[model samples]
Target chain A: MDEKQFRDYLSSYTDAEKALSAPMRDTIRINTLKIPKKEFMGVSGLKMEPTFYENGFYADAGPGVRLGATWEYFLGYMHTQTLSSMAPALVLNPGERDIVLDAAASPGSKTSHMSMLMNNKGAILANDVNWERGSALFSNIARLGVLNAKVTVRDATRLGINAYFTKALVDAPCSSLSQPYAYKKFTPNLSYEISKTQIKMLFSSYDALAEGGELVYSTCTYEKGENEEAIKLLLEKRGSASLQPLGVEFPHEPGLSEYGKEFRKVARVYPQHFSSEGFFIAKLKKGSA
Target chain B: MSHVTTFREYLQRQFGAEVPKEIVLNEQEGVIRAYSKTLMMLKPSGYMGFVAGKVSTRGIEVKSEFAQLLRNPSRNVLALDEAQAKAFVESESVAIAEQGEGLRIAKFGRHVLGVGILKAGSLHPDFIGKGRKRVENSINP
Candidate 1:
């Protein structure tokens, strides 16, 4: 809302490097299993670093680099995914034969990564609402040599409640507030007007996930109103689901109580802390087995 | 399932030929299972969805789309216009060669999807595993 509140809003973040400059574009993960590290270097001719936690290579999208049309990418060997974006899939740990759904998968970075991690052994339904976006998702999945994936064009909120999945990933569409370039008016105070759609899609994700199934809800935004508060409300509607803790060593900022009890297990990554975009993640296990 | 038969009939009328009886049409799931000496999976639009990931003594593991096509290859070839049929046949030939025999062909249909040289005359199906060196013909053929 204001600079003071913005400072206080991020006060809990331990690595509040208030002086740091914002990055122009986010990092991307190159699928190294198909394109080996050595070959990736040769093709992009760019220095690459692997994220410590996942099998993805990160490159700065700053200077004269066209990542999409390159040979490595056209062959379906790489996806532009953020480091923190990889966390929820790891948290979900979907297995082969398990039915997985990615509710908001467009330009499919995490969806392709999950398919490979599953070793192309399970069914992954990657759904996106927009026709153009869904087509883009399908193209990326095809380029990756994925055989066990299916694409659907539908409003994720309308994916029937009758369906069940071993695991679900809802990278819900949220306010891009955490992006440094977001207009000042996008803050949580404006949540009433802008966040309504996100709130609806998030609940729809929970409805689509089956009993005893696990859903990892994630958003790139850092605000409690969108992340923790949404989880808290969803937990209230579906009491059977509860939050699970993250094992990765990440910093926990203080005074974020606006999200209530559910915030304890939720994980947040700040731009200052992870050298990446701000992200919020929470893992919820559905009905007990 | 009736959608498959209706679609098959419509195709037969359009092409003026008897559709193959073994075609298993599944329009509801948006997939088709076609069975012959080999299995083919097909989508409603007659596109090959997948090929058999495995070969079996009993039945082949047809992909979702080709499994639908195997039952009525004629209806499929006829489903497209002469130009499209020719293109489909060429593309399918390449896909089948590459997938079933590990032979990459430079052209499929009118467009070229890759630059694989055709194997010397009468390329043995046995040469399929040559794409990967570690694979040896240890299994009795």
Candidate 2:
């Protein structure tokens, strides 16, 4: 979007600039696959406060606390993540017995989080289209002691079919509208292109799910076209697809019904709302036989 | 802790490290990996699963990812004091006569620091993966 349009769009939110530009506290999701959350909460040094979500924490240890530099982090007991980003995995809630697909997984924040959610049981196929990102993804997965997820550098839209996965997550990439802190390079044309790709990824994710399984389509960007529009298109094209209310409870806006009434079930997070990042999440269930 | 398999057999013999049998171990480009059995069914194209060890000129050298994955090793452990523990996180070498000449699990208190080579009475630790420890962070040596 252009400057005026962008400001107009952001104008709806309270303290949009100040909140988005503000530096957020580091969020640590305790890797229960390694160290139990309760035990980690007892560890000293870093000042930790629990979030509303289970196992999510706001961690700080003075200036330059370097949570990333601690043995606890390196040993895979914890992973540094944004609180906003944690919501997708929590919403997906892949169980120990379910096979999962994480399309467009890179740097593996959500993918590894799903691995932890699965408790290292069942399986996950984490695919990223970029080679460099795949390396970082594998690094995070291995470092976090995530053994249930496998890394693949390939176009996520081309992944094998057969309704294999019980659950799927497409945290599709988008322009950094999520973080006004580092937000740039947003244009109507670019957003349209990206939205197209997001729809394709969403379709692939839904198709990858087994009949009766669920698919979660999420993006860091909140543009109507990127978030609600993508889901809207999926529901229209695939009659089997239907929006499901996010069983997850976190602070955020309800999805816009502009696309359709069911879009309200989608979760839309605005950075200004809680000084978190902008994110959109929607849970969809595939019709079963 | 009981792990004696082809990928990390030497570690089992050396440090009594335990690797679960459920892992489908495979060696890719000198590094040994343990993949999820269910994930392996898809035949992923790029990197997959956890790294167990590496194939060096001498033999399989189990890395710190293995220790971190397995968490605790039962034997051949070299416990480090404050000064030595500092050196371990910094990836430095310090002399320790406790463990015999070979690779041992370097420990600072009860936590595993990774696999270390204890040869000629000196220990060199390697905690593989991103985000290493800050030297300022202390451990009782």
* lDDT (10s digit) by residue, model 2, range B40-129: 655445566867777666855777776766634788887777678777777778888764687778777766767888888888776655
Q: Between which residue pairs do clashes occur in model 2?
A: A1-A187, B81-B141, B82-B140, B82-B141
Task: Rate residue B69 of model 2 by lDDT.
Answer: 60
lDDT of 1 by residue, A50-126 (tens): 55664655664336545543334433446666777777777777776677877888877778778667765666777
Query: Across residues B7-37, which tens digit of lDDT does each residue of candidate 1 receive?
Result: 4554454323343443233432344422221
Runs of candidate 1 with Cα error greater than 4 angstroms are A1-16, A19-26, A32-45, A60-63, A185-190, A249-255, A258-262, B1-141
Badly placed stretches (over 4 Å) of model 2 are A1-5, A12-23, B1-8, B38-46, B97-100, B127-141
Give the distance in Å from residue A262's predicted Cα in candidate 2 to where it truly belongs: 1.1
Can you write out model 2's per-residue Cα lDDT over A1-289, one digit (the tens) per residue? Answer: 5555666676653345654466666778888877787676665456778777878888774575577776577667788888899998899899988888889888998988998888787888888889878778877887787888877776776665658788999999887686643345777789899888888788877888889999888888767888777887888899999888899888887877556677678887876545567788999999955
Alpha-carbon local distance difference test for all models? 0.54, 0.76
Error of 2 at A277 (Å): 1.1
Model 1 CA lDDT for position A97? 60
- Chain A TM-score per model, please list them: 0.84, 0.93
Give per-residue lDDT, candidate 2, residue A70: 68
